[model samples]
Target: MSIGDGYRAVVDLLRHLRFFVAVAETRHFGRAATDLGITQPPLSQGVQKLEGHLGVRLFDRDARGVRLTVAGGRLLGPARALVDAAEDLLDQAGRLGGPVRARVGLCGDLGGWTPVACRALAGGSGPGLVVPRVAGSDRLLAELREGALDVAVVRHPGVVDGLVGGDVVGLPTRLLGADGPLDVPLAEVDRPLVVPPRRHQPPAHDQLVDTLRRAGHDGRVLEAADPTQRAALVAAGAGVALETSPGAQASGGLPPLRVRVVLPAARERRPEVDHAGLAAALEQALRR
Candidate 1:
């Protein structure tokens, strides 16, 4: 018998599940320590403890490096699955009331946003924004999946293949007022770009990256952690950013800026996916 056998015999275990999984994935104790944001000796001790409890080897450890043993490779799949299930459970728990709140992503200003959309979600006919400020499409969608938001509004380049889309359109094409010609091979170097994180980047990020890459220039992307800071950076001409704000008419105290609200090009049009279906599905999940 091995430490692994004893470890798995219990109906449940705490803490070490993640640590064990990390060791199996990375193989090296030091590297796994770094990934877990801890130190090397502790990670090694924990893995040893797991092995001792299970009564079998989980890793082939040596000075050269670490690799998962047969037992570990077998356990890795199930362990990873467990982690995913736990995350999904947490996400479903965080949703709001019966109706569920939907999030919409706005690429441009809100002049084109219909009032009907806002009123339906606000749960009343009071004076308020429809989508409010979601920062960007990625943030809104993450909220949507996590049950924080039931619906989201996003611009479609028609490239997002799997998830359905609705009201697809490009945004106003505001030129950032370059010192040179509008179309002259533009490039932003060292300047900060206010954009979504790679993990949560929206269709807009992809399109913008493509555009910059085609022009032989890589744009710097600053994650949208702080909307105000991101906005300020863009305003100062430090970088270009995608934002959703109340239209100029509604933006009372905000600085006056002229931006081209470029709509999606014809090739970028996406088919309308039913918002009703998404709402229904979300509601059912919360009930359970």
Candidate 2:
């Protein structure tokens, strides 16, 4: 076989090349499996496939562990180099001509994350129009502080120093449960609440709490981070969870939740921006 063709044959091997290499570096099959978060049987099979492709043994096994054969030693650096080069290429693409990426928050409170930003996902990523997802919350406050996101939709019970809310709209706070729409006022139900923590509290939670008490029943907020978990808890007949305008119902055992504005007390909070210029550019692009 030609030398270039031989190299290509070795390089084209599937999964086990890395598995074999990891075992060689770690000097233990168990360690390699742990590193890859997989079981050792599959790791052994991968190594076997890789060795078969090369027509040479890749490692020397012993009572203690494994060590690389001469053939294995030769392949290690090149394999790692290939993986690193691919990662670098991807990172560069995300930063350059890929899309107009932004971190935006959308909650019952009509924050600065305009419909335009969320709508970008409907369109593919390109020069002026990539709505790559970061997260969905005023939690942009954290990302903005870390300088990771270009702009974010942030809301407050009060004002932020540098950020400003976009042409914001007010979302109605509603009582949501496992079935269709709920008609009872908050004072009537004596259920626990699934809610975002105060640090991550969306505007609807605050209104739900206040409206519940005013309507006559006391309100308490139970904290859960994942939406599906909250829905599951509700399905288990745990209690009533608050629903905001933008979030949709999750599928499976969870009943489609109900929503209606039982109170007029709550209002919309504004999302703040740091650089008006970036916000303006994104907003303009999103409008298209």
Q: Where does candidate 2 stray beyond 4 Å?
A: 1-99, 105-117, 120-128, 132-138, 155-159, 202-208, 246-288
Name the regions of candidate 1 deviating beyond 4 angstroms.
Answer: 1-120, 123-149, 155-162, 173-194, 197-199, 209-224, 235-237, 240-288
lDDT of each residue in 1-288, candidate 2, tens digit only: 323666565444524556766787799998787655455897898788777766888888989668888877898888677656755776677578544444433332332234544554334542243333333344444344333454554333322323344653233345567784455766676887776554553553565567557667677767665666777776776777755434433222222222111111112111222244445544444333
Q: Which candidate comes out best when scored by TM-score?
A: 2
Q: List model 1 lDDT by residue over 1-288, tens digit each.
A: 433656554323334566788778777676676555455776778778767866778888677888888998887888788766765766576343233333444322332343333544454333222344444444444343333443555434423332344433333333332242122233434354465455444444566666656545565566655556656666767675443322312212212222111122233222232345444332232222
How many clashes does each candidate structure show, in the order listed?
28, 5
lDDT of each: 0.48, 0.52
After superposition on all C-alphas, the RMSD of every candidate to the true structure, in Å, is 12.4, 13.8
Q: Return the lDDT, model 2, position 166.
A: 61
